[model samples]
Target: MTPLDKIRNFSIIAHIDHGKSTLADRLIQRTGGLSEREMSAQVLDNMDIEKERGITIKAQTVRLEWKGHVLNLMDTPGHVDFAYEVSRSLAACEGALLVVDAAQGVEAQTLANVYQSIEHDHEIIPVINKIDLPSAEPEKVKTEIEEIIGLDASNAVLSSAKSGIGIDEVLDAIVERIPAPKGDPDAPLKAMLVDSWYDPYLGVVILVRVIDGTIRKGQQVKFMATGTTHLIDRVGAFTPKLENLPDLGPGEIGFITAQIKEVAQARVGDTLTDAKKPAAEPLPGFKEVQPVVFCGLFPVDAADFEKLRESISKLRLNDASFSFEMETSAALGFGFRCGFLGLLHLEIIQERLMREYDLDLITTAPSVVYQIELTHGGGHIDLHNPADMPEPNKIETISEPWIQAVIYVPDEYLGSILKLCQDRRGIQQNLTYVGGRAQATYELPLNEVVFDFYDRLKSLSKGYASFDYEQIGYREGDLVKMGILVNEEPVDALSMIVHRSTAETRGRGMVERLKELIPRHMFKIPIQAAIGGKVIARETISALRKDVTAKCYGGDATRKRKLLDKQKKGKAKMREYGSVSIPQEAFIAALRMGDDA
Candidate 1:
């Protein structure tokens, strides 16, 4: 084992596509963590989705040996949805490599993650990445780092990770500048459960950073939060691939298999201690994550409901932040009301369910949690699903979650971005200039921001704008549930809570989109969007008519009139009694209308 003074633990934090993973790949290669034959682009990103999307969904850890010192590096996801992952990774390390795109300078996520590093009291090493690009201005980025992040970047490393530039200098800087972790090996085992995931062969594999004492194979460890003990089956570190180790000592990061059946039991951020001699107190900074978005997930075929449940449970073992509970929809049948970190998280979970488990799913419109204040001295209750919302009569006031967003954009696109925010009922909190770019901060309802807001922001800015947001609590609003009715029957999956001002336009958009999506039937189908008893928007799917008049040929005018009257009567009766057969495709397409609208 390396001495405490010779070990450096650090994580790479950056904005999306700023080359965090590429830097990690270069580090692993330079340190000989993996051979040339085994090396690949984004070597640490092992998942297929991560490779395809070119984004790290989970924070990955690797142990490397450079010169004489032992280096523990974590490659963290840079997207706003995975900020929690970055934070967890930061908690395990004493230093962070703050990567900034030389061309783009400081984006929103760069500031966000760097602030998190500062909060963790990490020694941050500023690295100007993508220096090989023609637009790259390493000096400008260095200034931005100093001005925006308030970190001295005069000695910041200038490198192009793609071309392996400054790789050695980065290593040298890490060893010289980043402080060595200080922990007590003589003390009882106190490891931080940075992350955990399910492994088919060995069960739950936990990634831990040993803070005090050592963790050895066959040692009984207790999870402080869950109050469960498990016998360690294996101890190892990821050299980009699992390599068995005898034990992980203080200031070292590694993995351990404890024969735990589920990852839920090995909670992330939990303290792991020797079962025989438990630590006097668990480590601090542990808090449960509250999901920001909620939606119903149902198998397209009702027969696959049980399979979906099994698949979701298996998925939950991998994602501790995702939460789900059983829910039945009148239109969609059995399903689970699942909560996620954000819109991207919802999409990833849906995609994984379909791809990994081979399950076809129907997802409802995603909505943010609402707080409903009841009338007559009734207590407040958190509303997850709009369909489950209490009656309007009992609701004294409905408050929706709000978020404070920081957007970084070029000055040319500032006007358009501000307009888009205003259209979402946003209130501008502050706006300032950072070099040629504008840093605009706005407080907007989370419900408005959730639907295609990021996509809109990017398009308006020509993909130059970067945004990051955090929940700022709830505020009272004129919120009302808008229910969509097909053939005058309410579709629970299509129901959503909306502000009163935009209800008409949103309702009209949904009804108009549904009119195009739902196929015509023998009887006329009336699609209506309603708020309470008021029908805000309405559309009619014209009936598929037969040529009853054509069969009449050239008869008396009354004969044609009589045939039309009879047909109209028959259609009216069918409209009254006939149930609309809405295909699964319609619901799928209708929910996506929010993005388009």
Candidate 2:
């Protein structure tokens, strides 16, 4: 094992599309972690969805040897939705590489990540990436970093990870500048469970950082959080690929695999210690991540419901942040109501469920958790689904979650971006200019932002804006649950909680979109959006008419009238007895109206 002073553990932090993964690839290549035959783009991004979408969904760790020193590097996701992953990764490291795009300078997420590293008291080394681009402005980015993050950037390393420039400089900086992790080599074995995932060949692979003592094969270890013990079958480190080692010593990051069947046995942020001689106290655990968005995921085929349940359980083994519970919907049948960090997270989980498990799913419209206060001495209840809401008379006030958003945009799009925020009932907190860009902070209801605010903001800024937000608790608002009725029958899957002011417009949009999506039936189908018994918006799908008079071309007027009357009576009877069979495609499309609009 490498000596403590020669060990360096750091995480790569940056905004999305800002070269965090590229920089990691270059470092791995330069250190010869893998041979040319084994090398690939975004080597740390092992999932196909991650590679295809050009995003990192999970934090990846790799250990490398550079100039006789062991460097443990973690590549973290840059998207705000994955900020929990970033924070957890940071907690396992002593320093961070704050990668900033030379052309884009400091973005909202860059600032957010830098602040997280600061919270962790991490030694941050600024690296100006993408210098080979024609529009690269390294010096300006350095200035922006110093001004915004208040970090010394005068000696920042300028490099192009894509072109393999300044790779050695980065390695040297990490070795020389980042402090070595301090731990007692002879103490009881104590390690932090940085992450864990299910491996088909191996039940569960746990990534751990040894803060003190050693973790060895055949050693009995206990998870402090779960109070479960396991005999370590294998201890290894990632050379971008698994490499077995006899043991991991102090200040080293590595993985340990046991014949653990249950995923919950190895919890992220749990402390691991030798079962025979456990540490006096467990290490501080990571903060629990709360799900911000909730939606119902139903199987299109009722028979697949059990398969969906098993799939969700397996998925939870990989992703601890996602949560779900059994819920039965009137329209969608039996399904699971899953909670996620955000919309992107929800999308990824849904996509992974479909791709990995090969299950056909019908996802209900996404909703945010609302706090409902009951009248007169009644207790407050958390509302995850609009259909589960109590009667309006029993509720005192409905409070919706709000978020504090920070956006950075070019000066040209400042006016329009601000307008879009205002149109969503956002209250401007502050607006300031930095060079040719503007930074605006606003507090907006989370429900509004969750629907389509991000998409609208991107379009308004022509995809030049960067946004980051954090939930700022909850506030009482004039929120009402809007229910959709097709042929006077309520659709629980189509219900949503909306602010009173925007209910009509939102409801109108939904009903109009549903009219176009739902196929025409033999009888007219009336779709209405309502708040309680009051209808806010309505649309009708005209029935397909069959001319009964075509056979009687020259019949008498009274005879034609009599035939028409009979036909009208038959149509009225059909309308009363007939039910609208909304296709699965219609539900999916109508639910996405917020995104398309």
Candidate 3:
């Protein structure tokens, strides 16, 4: 059982809930890498949010030393928002063990990660996980994996990570096949921060793979991006548990702690090297992540805004993917303007913030970007945010984001789903029957998918359909600008883009919805949709004059005026376009509606 010669650096990749963590647990135990006292049902799910949501939001690394070869195992987040995190995990590995669910087969995220693995030029070993399920059909899954992931799965390791069935085969397969990381162990210092976290006690704990040279405790190191160098205080590896490694070099994965207090200090792609003898260059290839879904997140109580801000700051330090900014709206009050990888990413973040930070928040609906057209004099200007929306009678054309969607559903519900797509303004392209199901492709507006898209899919397919999409670029479609006017003033946040075909429908629905959501005020609210200054659709919220007449409590009236002043102050912060007080949530919620039509 010699250590260096048999070491294998591999990561388990899968789509969300495909059981990457469960498989990790079995491998750690099967390799005799951990004791009974150390093994838990899902030992790798160290965070409370992950355990509860049953999803891995962060990447975790552990080592299984077997037959003298140390097999470094990294588990990655299966969701797309964590795709960047997945890429970071891949950078630290020499090979990837793709775990395909035998029953569910391949998904969009599966393709995403496979593309990522190929992009990294990783050696991939396919493993057919979840083979114990009644729906499990290993041969079908194998073929699909090979077809979709463009990988060889002929000798796929079939196993149930839960019962530990055939788990040893998966381990031996990695040892026999996956090669050790190839790098100059004696070269100048260079390392990759695969994933990291902020330990209240230990500061920024980084999981790094030393590509060359060596790093040890108290060594002054430079972080390539932040330029905030620090002296390493501790170095260790997860031998299924924290076993301090004196130093890390080529072909090994381990943890190192710095006196640095924040996750920002240890940027994932930053190269760690001795300032005196740095590597010729850091490992190339790091991408800036952009959030797809934007929404307003606020504490129900204004006092908790600061608390929510602190929580998000701490959380983002560990998760570079999580992004947010302070935002306030007359309709939604004060909260953080947060961006997510997508819808699921949005949900998981909200849930984590609530569960971990223990803050109750009001989340406004989500929205997508709209192309605004402002016709000032004889010229025109296009805008993406409502803040840039044109004033009434001065706008000529407006556009919304669009997409080309492909939905895969069961044969039984094929007809129903097709009809649903058509109803949502989707131009059906082709329907191919694959195996016993149908893969339906269509060109749909991104605005359509921003709202009710998921719910519609579930309804039409009876919940058996699955799909994914990439921005195919926008078209000069029939989109229109709609406004929700409050007190004869347009709220910038509420100015939005809608398909011209549905502009009236959206205007009416949003007005009605807003009227219900908005509290009675001293003024009437009008929700309207206009095409070239033609008011095609409109809704109004009647003003209410409910003043307490209980002797107008002398000093209490002053307190009431202060509260009214605060509310007015809040409303004024929002961008004004026309007469609509469109809150941030209304903007986001409309797009997140996921209803293409």
User: Model 2: residues >4 Å from true position, as ranges?
Assistant: 551-557, 595-597
Give the range where candidate 2 is weakest over 10 consecutive residues by summed lDDT.
Answer: 588-597
Model 1, 190-279: lDDT tens digits are 999998888889888999999999999999999998899989989999987889999999999999998888777877788999999999
> For each candidate, what is the lDDT?
0.91, 0.90, 0.73
Candidate 3 segments exceeding 4 Å error: 1-4, 368-385, 388-406, 415-432, 440-447, 470-481, 486-494, 515-534, 540-597
Candidate 3 local lDDT, 1-597, one digit each (tens): 123556788888787678888888888887777877867877888878788778887788987877768888888887755767788888788789888889988765677677788888788888888788998999998888776566888888888888789887887888888877777777888998887898888888999988888888889898876777788899998876778877887778899998777775677777788887887777876656666666678786788888998999978877666678776666556777777777777787888789888998776556665554556545545342344455556666655555666677888998888877786788888887657777788887766675567787887777678766666664666555566565555554465666667777777666666665555545555656555557776667665544435434667568787766765554444323224434444455543433432
The top-ranked prediction according to TM-score is 1
lDDT of candidate 2 vs native?
A: 0.90
Return the lDDT, model 3, position 276.
78
- Kindly give the stretch of ten consecutive residues in candidate 3 with the minimal lDDT sum: 573-582
